[model samples]
Target chain A: MSETKKLMYVNRKAPYGTIYAWESLEVVLIGAAFEQDVSVAFVDDGVYQLCKDQDTTGLGIKNFSATYKALGDYDVNKLYIEKESLEARGLTLDDLMPLVYEDEDDDWAEKDSIKVVSSQEMAELFEQSDVLFNF
Target chain B: MKLSIQVNEGPYNHEASVSALNYTKAALEAGHEIFRVFFYHDGVNNGTRYTTPPQDDINIANSWSELADKHGLDLVVCVAAAQRRGIVDEGEQERNGKDGNNIAPGFRISGLGQLIEAGIQSERLVVFGD
Candidate 1:
């Protein structure tokens, strides 16, 4: 209602091993409807969520990985990946899905939304957020 | 300070629900204003009256019900999550054609927007779970 408040949705779990990741994504999708300043942070096992080639066919579970791509359309552009988390998981930005959003203010130019930041920078982001929803 | 609470885990299986209850009770006793308590994920299980633990153990949902009644707290169980887990109220029961509703007293089924609203309105938002 008031001017947008900075909201950080912190994900710390793997996408499939538990329900946290999927539910967190649901919250983000719903929260996006509110038109608030939103940021999604992937830390620890949460980093696995963005890994490309996610195959859930054998698992017989609904694969929600592709939903992350749709986030751009919701105006939820900021996706922060902790550098340490990716390294610990032996993943690089190259291993992640290339998520991009169109810049409406700049003639709809496409730009990358994923930003690999250090843990310190993640902490600074934590401080910068008006509210934090952890999953 | 005005605060909001989020519970992400189910009762008994994890200590999170009870811990949230304790923390909320403490906060209320300390004279802090609780803007809302939004239950999501498996946390919606905390709103069901179907939980029947050992007689010696605590009834987590009842504890929350009693607390909400006493403090006039807003205990909101997310509708989407609740429907998934089958924690329904009378309205949900009628709409979903459920045989009966299991929502406990003082707990209401609502949308995730309640959570976003809590984050926007509260001075502090506390989360309890992994």
Candidate 2:
């Protein structure tokens, strides 16, 4: 078996407007299938991707937010959200989907856990990963 | 590590620019050099200096300029994409009979060589699309 490498996936697009967001999620899933240690970070408008309620039917787009909930099943649970992004959007921790972790939470106490982080901290996540994918 | 970063969305149109910036910062922080950052399709809009987002909104063009200023990062915009979008540098402006160059301060209009170079230079090349 090939040695597993750590990878970080950064999602920065909203869910419905473009294919970037969904494509990024697909990449994460592919990485996980390879047994790579995959982590995903949602920043900027990408935070909208994890909103508790997403209805893409009206937009004629498939709803992929549910796929995010399945990340855990693939062990791709190192999901992150930017603290400032949430606030700028007038969204709070509770407004997001349950899979996300805020920067303040203890759940991400471990170095390997998926957690929310500041912009500065996000830089660190990139530094640590063997591969960094931005989508 | 060979780093090939593909930026697909336009500047300020979404968070892809910020993510690209953050990814660049992280790559540099990790002591790794960036191979190349390729701006394609709508991503070519990122190379324009003429953009002015609302004061309250984040300035992606400025963010990209800062990255180039601080790190000397190579920002490459696909010429075909740029031309189609009406984004050209001074030389192109003269050749195409355009009024002026709209490219951002730090960006350079180049061909796919830069993209190929990025793929060969970085250990991992990631694509950020919109």
Candidate 3:
């Protein structure tokens, strides 16, 4: 059997006003479909992607944020958020979707689970990954 | 390990530039050398010297330039992409009958060979696109 590939998806843009967020999600879903070990990290304005109260109906745009919730169904459950980003945006864990892991989780609590991390930790994740995709 | 990065989206148009920067930084930090960073499509706009983002916004072009300057990085902007986007050096500007040159320092206008060479030589090649 082929070894599972370690893939990391880095998102650094806002959820709306651009296609990067949606396209990045598409890549992640496809990667998951291949059974690749995938993890997604939201940084900078990308944190907006997990905000709970998004409303895109008024703009006549499809609500791509919902697609994020479906990522888990594809086995893309390793979602990461930069702690500093959330704090900078004045967003707490409660303000985000319930699927995300909180920052207070123990360092090695979940061996293969999604977890919020600091920028320094994110750098390490990038180094450890066999394949890294920036979107 | 050799690595090739293709930047196909312009700075500020999305997070392509930021992600490219972070990826490059991480690769270098992990002791992996970048074989080449090829800027194509709208990515050539990153080499434009006239870009000046607001103070509140991230100046992605400057970030890229600074990274290249610090690492002695090979920053290649596609010639065709630059010409189409009106980003050219002094010689190209003159040749194209353009009045001014907006190509930034530390960025080279080159052909697709750079990208092809990177793909052939690198163990892993990642592309950053819109």
Model-by-model lDDT, in order? 0.95, 0.76, 0.77
Local accuracy of candidate 1 as per-residue lDDT tens digits, A1-135: 867899999999999978999999999999999989999999999999999999999999999999999999999999999999999989999999999999999999999999999999999999999999999
Assess the local accuracy of residue B42 in candidate 1 as a C-alpha lDDT between 0 and 100. Answer: 91
Say which prediction, candidate 2 or candidate 3, comes out ahead on lDDT: 3
Of 2 and 3, the candidate ahead on TM-score is 3
Query: Model 1 over residues B1-130: C-alpha lDDT tens digits?
Result: 8999999999988999999999999999999999999999999999988889999999999999999999999999999999999998999999999999999999999999999999999999999987
List, residue by residue over B1-130, the lDDT tens digit for candidate 3.
Answer: 8888989799986788779989999998898898789887678899987888889987777777888898888999978667867888987988889888988777889875565455545678789874
Error of 1 at B79 (Å): 0.9
TM-score of 1: 0.98
lDDT of 2 by residue, B1-130 (tens): 5466888888666677779878888988898878678886678898888777899977887788888888888889977668878999998999899988888988999865455445434687877754
Can you write out model 3's per-residue Cα lDDT over A1-135, one digit (the tens) per residue? 155667778898888887668756755665565566778899999889888879998888878887787775676778888999999999877788767322334562323334789999988988988766676
Judging by lDDT against the true structure, name the best candidate: 1
Instruction: Give me the runs in candidate 1 sitting further than 4 Å from their true place.
Output: none
> Which runs of model 2 end up more than 4 angstroms from their true locations?
A100-114, B1-122, B126-130
lDDT at position A46, candidate 2? 93
Off by over 4 Å in 3: A100-114, B1-7, B10-122, B128-130
